[model samples]
Target chain A: MNKTGKKIFINGNEAIAEAAIIAGCRFYAGYPITPQNQIPEYMSWRMPEAGGVFIQAESELAAINMVFGASLTGTRAMTSSSSPGISLKQEGISYMAGCELPGVIVNMQRGGPGLGNIQGSQADYFQATKGGGHGDYRMPVLAPSTIPEAIEHVMTAFDLADMYRTPVMLLSDGILGQMMEAVEFPVYKSKKKLPEKDWILDGAKNRKPRSVFSLMMQNPTILEKHNYKLAEKYKKMETEVIHETYLAEDAEILVCAYGIMGRICRGAIDMARKEGVKAGLFRPVTVWPFASEVVSKLGKKAKKVLVVELNLGQMVEDIRLAVEDNKKISFFGKPGGAVATKEEIFAKIKELIK
Target chain B: MKAVYTKPISLTETANSYCPGCGHGLVHRLVAEVIDELGVRERTIGIAPVGCAVFAYDYFNFDVTEAPHGRPPAVATAIKRCLPDRIVFTYQGDGDLASIGTNEIIHAANRGENITVIFINNAVYGMTGGQMAPTTLEGMKTTTTTKGRDVKVAGHPLRVSELLSSIEGAVYIERVTVIDPANVIKAKKAIKKAFQNQIDKKGFSFVEVLSPCPINWGLKPLDALKFIKEKMMEYFKLGVIKDSTNSKESK
Candidate 1:
């Protein structure tokens, strides 16, 4: 166990890979894609040393399916890619969701409508939060604002995946994936024992035969029953939604943001506070199963709410749903590789507060 | 006391959904029999592909995972890697393996993934109506290739067993047909040998079963079998294309 708590300069992608290793990830299959290539590179070297398996699959489609296979065998598995690659992974992601397989998927989002840019972008908000894959399934999505949060979120992702028996996506942008920051590695504790493999198809040697399948057979009634089970699991996950509020109490204006955009919004909020505006910021850590109830509580005290995001008003829709028709909610955003800077967000906050 | 020959242990009691005379039912029974004879019914993991065999997970009493379209190779690769001691195999159709999933199968075999692939080459895509598949014969007509697969437009039919056998990583590659009782026996032997090669950890093993899709072929069950034997076998010869059992690498 690396108990020595030493501060090390690391990027968000590296932090996520190291944390995944600490969380007992024994299988990683991924392809090289911009902004998130560091993740696959790190895993390729680290997995071998940890006595884990690493495969550079032919494509994102193959990579994610490989993770699905490894996860089926009771191993902690993961894959990472940018937006286009993530799109390619959607089919496998849906399969993983259907099979209730546990694994981690990292999406270092770049601008996209079709291979948009290599720069930072949050255009995948709708795809990630609303379930990009086919079918009526939702993966728990985590948005990290800082390098440390990226590490912590990934560790939490593995636990949540195992707990719910579902895939979890860590949605970050190119900026977060590329920027370096001082981070302290989490204390590593080896699990006392590996989880029991009774459900896995390791081998039926001494036990009753086991099977892992997602098909409910073309029977509508059986499919409905299966879907009902999935819905029940999702309803239970509502309690796990997380968010953070800064000076939201006694504020007349509230700013809703997440991921890197949320971090920039904080700066805008600080600028507003110096200008005598009673403004606060609310950042959601878990985007899916959106922290609606938390935001609604904060909305009760605020006169108005403003959402700042990289995409053209994606998260704003969620914010609007959170506040309902009780308060006026406005959005400020830029799409296709344009990031919402502090100046732009501050300008929006000024207009909302005035 | 009277002795009875029951269905293979690996197969469930549920009746098969395959059309009467469909080779899938016969091949399934043969595979189940192999699993029973080898005493590996309990230690096997079958990956069912997206096609007519998508419901294969239900037919096999052992552990199974239904892979997405053309992704059975990738699924089987991962399963075998994670559980090397377990018998892992993928059952896929022409569209699943030769078309959408070509890269996955090729790469897995290139890496010498110790898994068996039961490639069902029925000439045309059976699940989604009579569409021309990667293995659809030249000059053969189907919904997608209504003008009879022109060699200039559609190119030649893919000989997967012969193609895979050329790869150094593949240890066993054979093409067989389930047309008659004798050929069915040979096909079963080929399937069992592919599984046995994996058990021996020789390398990647593939057995392409030339099957019949009667409805898609616009023929009766008997006519389809005859077409597979006389017509399809001319393009996809039935024999062992490659076998590493004689290679010094095995020793």
Candidate 2:
């Protein structure tokens, strides 16, 4: 059913699929994996009714490739998977990057290194922001703290992908993917003109046949030139979409986090403020072009910086890089698949303040 | 007199990256000639596989996407479905199609995707330094099979043509070789038929060519040709395996 202009209770995974459909994503191919299967489950039924195509591919590798194929033809395409399956998708993702095809990929992350527990964990933070695949390419990575925000990111991820002509990842963890929340289609579908997808391979028509590929292997000169061009594209993205701040103004202690941890930290900041301690929050909306400027500016008054996350502080390094020697940095984390409660974060804030 | 036989309009003027005596160049020429003859160059998209022929896009002057090893069929399936009015095909090697990507090929064929598949079977992994491929002949020596492929340990070479022909969606299946001029014509004819099937909106069509790699096969160009004629052909027999769209055959 097309749930446009309707509010319904949906999980994070289903929210993402509905957003993709509203965003004009008519093609989806994915193999089922833990914590992210609801996305494929939802799209399998929704896509056909929406006059689109859906394929339950044989493997994650094949699914990503199918997405590549659909995207190559200038169709809005997408795929979703979990940690292990995302690892398998790296090859096809790299190829798609090399070819510069625009598409959306959702990673409802779970614990990893290999078939780790299915519980929600933010363990793939490094893999999502840093290059999960090979090469010097970066995709715009969106992390949503709630099901509604995940829906918003899905709606925009496709536009960002086509805007930059690159893949955009809607990165969430199992917690957000599994939890149910009331979500509304935030924005009405737009009638904006998309950039000329003149490079798509739909039978060159009257124009010269254009080849979309990433193999500059035969000539170092061409390959080097291509890399430089991609670097310039990435540089243009640094100013695109950055972060969100909560009560960041005039605070002595600033906490930096993202996704579920950021949501938890927001609750803790309220608790700490009620206890007469000055605390603020910096949440990075995009992991690649991280909110470095916001962190640097927000940490100007705070005497101490606290970084909270799951899986042994993966995002702390980004925070450290942003604030560098200007403030004392403290860290807290759970190993994997363990959620940090609001009370635990508030206690950490109290100890750091003390 | 100047020659009238210049390169086909579909072939680019750039030099091909294929090594000397590699059968890929002939196959590329055959595909290009077929596209020119069919007057479908404007609407045809070719998928280059991951192997020595990975650089096939440089030679073919058409829209081409480079697929990961053994994944061209699945990629082609999506492209053809999204743009069914356009002509799409995948050119893949033996190790690419028969081994790592075997499942994708089977499923795409089973689904009856309206696309063309050009499979090149040379029995050894050419660019990867003569590795023992899934189609490596029994008792054949390769880098991984230094002692020659022992059937007791290594599995038998795949008869992909015979195997894929059994699938219901595969409308046409043939195996041809390009060791000689006469055989080259036959290979071109098979490729032409495969493309024609897609043009007719028939289901999946496949043609496997017994190509040769002189450098990897440890033979001179002529000897490579002779090897395909004598040794490779004996194991991978050349013929039509299926034609479901033929007037003689029922659905």
Q: In model 1, which regions exceed 4 Å deviation?
A: A1-4, A188-198, B1-6, B248-251
Tens-digit lDDT track for model 2 on B1-251? Answer: 99876788889998987779999999999999999999999899999898888888889988888888899988998898788888899999998999999999999999888899999999999988999999999998999999899988998999998999889889999999998888999999999999988888887999999998988888999999999888999999899999886642321
Candidate 1 C-alpha lDDT tens digits along A120-155: 989999999898999999889999999988888888
Clashes, model 2: 0
> For all candidates, what are the clash counts?
0, 0
Q: State, as a TM-score between 0 and 1, how close model 1 is to the true structure.
A: 0.94
Show the colliding residue pairs in model 2: none
* DockQ each: 0.64, 0.78
**Number of the predicted model whose DockQ against the real structure is largest:** 2
The C-alpha local distance difference test score for the whole of candidate 2 amounts to 0.88
